[model samples]
Target: MIDFLTAGLVLGCSAGFSPGPLLMLVISETLTHGTRSGVRVALSPIITDFPIIAATLLLLMNLSGYHGILGGLSLAGGLFVLYTGYHSLTARPVQLDLPKEPPKSLRKGVLTNLLSPHPYLFWITVGAPLLTRSLKVGPAAFVAFIGSFYLCLVGAKIVLALAVGRSRAFMGSRAYLWIMRLLGALLTFFALLLFREGLKLLGVG
Candidate 1:
């Protein structure tokens, strides 16, 4: 349970801090409108991800009888996370170039997140299995995982928006690189955990 919470926290923070279309929109909105607009963008994931997660969980639940297949998915998810961590660790600074379009912050944010492939891919491959496993442990464990995840995810983005609103130059600083590397390390650790879990499920651990 504690591990689930910790993994959620680190994974959420990593995703939140990573450069993406949604993050770009957040920065652009903040630069154009205000912090409130940026926050709305940060909140987009909450609105968009529920359906995706639900569908993924539903599919995973239906497939629960197939342990070998599920184990393969878990192994793949772990490998994906390991790849993500390595990419993050070697990533360069984010270069923010604000778009000239008018700000429809909430609508644009929703569309951006919904259309993005990352959320769908993540929920299907990584989040679903983990969430299903947590649910088996207890409802509280599942809630802890999700609650901690979104709290850190949205919180980090909100902080970034606020900070960027105050000073635009901070996004390209050394602090960003350090944070990325730290999150990468944490993600790598979580990936190992997931891989081990996969191996156990496959009866090979």
Candidate 2:
């Protein structure tokens, strides 16, 4: 259970650090709608992810009859996390093509990730099993699991938004190279760990 909590937290941090369509929207909101909207974007995941986790867990419970399939799905989920982390570390910021306002753009960003297949895939494969396995340790253990998972998942992003939004004084003086690069390195480690966990599911590790 400790191992599961640790791994989920690591993977959650990796995912949160990476900027995506939603993140881009958050930035746009920060620029146009002000820092508050970006902060809302941080909280939006709370609205989305908990239900996602629940729905995903229910589905996985139904599919529990097939261990091999479950294992394969876990491997796939792990690989997807690895890919997203790699993409995050290397990702170039999206260039704005159309001149648009922030609110609409932010809404779009929120919708994109929420509607994307990736979140469902991750929860279905990796998160559900990690959670279900933790639950067998009892309810308190499960609550700890939930608490630990979000502490990294949601908390990391909120801190990130706050840091970037608040960096006015230090902006341009330091390029934020060190911290960004350090996150990239951590992301890489996170990717490998997910791969390892996936392999464990497949009985390959």
- The candidate maximizing lDDT is 1
| Model 1: pairs clashing at backbone N, Cα or C within 3 Å | none
| Residue 62 displacement in candidate 1 (angstroms) | 1.3
Best candidate according to TM-score: 1
| Candidate 2: tens digits of C-alpha lDDT, residues 1-205 | 2366666666666556555556555655665566776667766666677788998888877876776777777667667766665665565534432236646543565676698776777788677777776777777666766777677766766665665577533212233334344556665665566567656656788
Residue ranges of candidate 1 with Cα displaced over 4 Å: none
lDDT of candidate 1 over 25-96, digit per residue (tens): 899899888889999999999999999999999999999989898989989889888988997798787888
lDDT of each: 0.88, 0.63
Span of 10 residues, lowest total lDDT, candidate 1: 1-10
TM-score attained by model 1? 0.96
User: In model 2, what is the error at residue 44, expressed in angstroms?
Assistant: 0.6
Per-model TM-score versus the true fold: 0.96, 0.76
RMSD of each: 1.2, 3.6
